[model samples]
Target: MMPETFLSWWQFNNARGKQPDMSNKCPPVLHVPAAGEQAQRLAALSQTFISAFTQQPQFFTRAPGRVNLIGEHVDYCGYAVFPMAVEQDILVAVAINTSGRLNICNVDANFPPYSCDINNYEINKERPVWHNYILSGVRGIQDEGGMQQPFIGINMAVTGNVPPSSGLSSSSALVCASALGMAHSHGLSLSQETLAEICARCERHVGTQGGGMDQAIAFLATKDTAKLIEFNPLQATSVTLPPGATFVVANCLAPMNKAANSYFNCRVMECRLATQVMAKKAGLPWRTFQKLGDLQRALDKTLLQMITLVEDSFEVRPYSKRQVCELLNTTPDELNQVSLSENTRHIQEFKLHDRALHVFSEAHRVWEFKKVCVEGGAYALHTLGRLMQESHKSTQLLYECSHPKLDTLVELSKGLALGARLTGAGWGGCMVALVEEDKVEQYKEHLWKSYYSKEAAAEGRPRNTLLFSSPPGPGACVFVK
Candidate 1:
């Protein structure tokens, strides 16, 4: 069924000349639910928009946050990642205006209100505020559409349930929802694949060098399945999760804002450096290689072989700047210019051996995870759980991304959960656990008593939000009036 979004686009394009039909490729459009909790929330959101702008909204867009069941920190390495969308999401109430200015307000008063000329706004990388994420989406669409005329300005009222900075991808969902609203406003009908790619690239404007996993899953997810999202062309394949498996996510109450610090980009740079060093050793042009996955393809080696290569090529000790420079046959300045990001350019040492090992092994774990899910059996859950445990260990020991609090949560889930691991960039965030359907309540209560109840930060927050089971939910979509 063609949603109002596509129908409106078809009507708009008919006047301007025909455009490619992308109905199947675009996000599904559905009527706003007439009753139930979603309807109530959207109804309240519509009223919030009217109260803020004194006019009815044109439409609404939603983009869900995701949980990476496995495959952590491997997307930027150009490897496939397994992630499923969650029920929590960011929703925007949007209306077009001829004022040529963007007006943005948040339902939560903490954000306050923001405005800028539609054609004149810059995303603040140094101190990115909430609206900067929305602006990033607008800017991305503007760049992609390249309209000669200024885009009709938009008024947006934003509300989200996804916990911010707790690594459930709250930031990416905002960018995607905003992007979807902007595209629909302009009568542009881009495919979901195109939108996901654009949002992924544009979110970097906020200065976090993330792999595309979050954004890819934001758009490509379906209602009841997890997706194996591959990069270098961005394809998603549905993988049925083993039956009777329930995934529970628990926030450690520690928030790591990726763009606000250097940890995330530091890891990215380390991976790049490792890939280059490996390439240089293999007689391949090191400068041309950035992702370990690319290097693996060039060498025509399996993931296991790459792990072996990592062991043989480097020591467990961190590589000093001088050591890396000498190995690459380049000076420190050249190394910084070629391989490092602005945030990671300063005095540094890199743990190349462990980082490369984590990435290669984690990539292999993703494949193993897919295999176990595809070939489900009595032992499938046990095997998948073991793979998850191994992935977490690699993230903790080798990647060095897991937080103490995150590790504590994982540790707390030891006997109750099949396996648990930190789910996002993980300098401090949330952990996802594979729990059986029958054990979900028991698992959550165990964590609450052992972890959340004692934490001062989780005080006064709803227990369900802090600890809940998240099945694979639907991808991003639009709800039109």
Candidate 2:
């Protein structure tokens, strides 16, 4: 039976003045395209179900997918980053629930029902041992606020197009969506700082330790521009782009599951170790050296100084993204005594390795990256792109993070007269390519004919080289229908 058609609030969220109960300020907005939306309409139209389920329409909120233009792997250390929102975002429409629980539904047929009892959720150092990023946001809201701030149940339906683990900050989008949805539902006010903290901590519930880069921009980004996220001091700015210049990001459906190798955590530990070695050499506390850029300065001084202080301490193993794929030959669940954190110590590398050199310099590149974008300098962007390719060489050569197939895509991207870099933690994931808008068509064709479709013909793989533009999508905001 064709489902009844109630007003599609989410579909119309972007319509001017369509958002309900919003004040004069440019409130954060969301748009959710979901199958659960149909379910809601069906339930509303069906007399018996509407009466039985209880009907209370409420506000919808959303957060967008994020691509870190620069400053990868820096957020966890509290470094500033540059990120923008895209047109794609997760939309959440929430209503108050007397039952006092977070009820969630999605349009995606594959998405299962997700629910949590608000009364029972916890946000302590070790709690909510689940993948519910929103639960952590809820915990943050409660913990960060006073008891005088009461809580309310949320009846919600969420849906978005961003793929999970695609290095697009999809999870952060969900966290931001839920945060603002709940905030609006209960008439609460929040700032970017508060929202970012909530989202970052919530991510930890799922066993990932990350800084707040994704959450911050998803929560705070404005429209059609870039934002620079600063780390040494936590500040953000919306930057205007040079005329006729756009950032083109291509997503390869070749989503390598980063979780398998704890790729994110391993890198974090490596950074910690690198800092410790640098600290001893500097005769200062590890915490004193603020940015990764600082460590590079110390390392450049002399090899004797580094060798004495960072001998075994500078550990770089083959635990990179490519190595993870090779290691996948073993079944993760079947293995006993498998500790990523423990074996992490195994993959440590020498501090003086070229990859470390790339990493050490990459920290500085992020800042230079911002300068090019902000200065509207063509030479600067291209110059930065050269550094990016250099960075890729480091990841592929020094860090050993590239797969033959992955490297092919980078080569393919470069062949199309574009500048490219291996994005995310590397391995078999997609790379970020900056192509002129005019050249996008040629780039797409080259990628497919060269690699994606070739994989299809040989192994019957689905389309792999997916391409899109990166928009400065906003964080969690509410929309009413």
Model 2: per-residue Cα lDDT over 378-424, one tens digit each: 57556656766776676777555566666776787775544676666
Instruction: Point to the candidate with the largest TM-score.
Output: 1
Off by over 4 Å in 2: 1-56, 122-131, 147-150, 257-261, 286-356, 398-404, 457-465
Against the reference, the lDDT scores of all candidates come to 0.90, 0.57
Q: In candidate 1, what are the lDDT values of residues 135-191, reduced to their tens digit?
A: 889988988844556787789999999999989999999999999988877767788
Give the Å error, residue 129, model 2. 10
Task: Give the 10-residue window scoring lowest on summed lDDT in candidate 2.
Answer: 1-10
Q: How many residue pairs clash in model 1?
A: 0
The worst-scoring run of ten residues by lDDT in candidate 1 lies at: 13-22
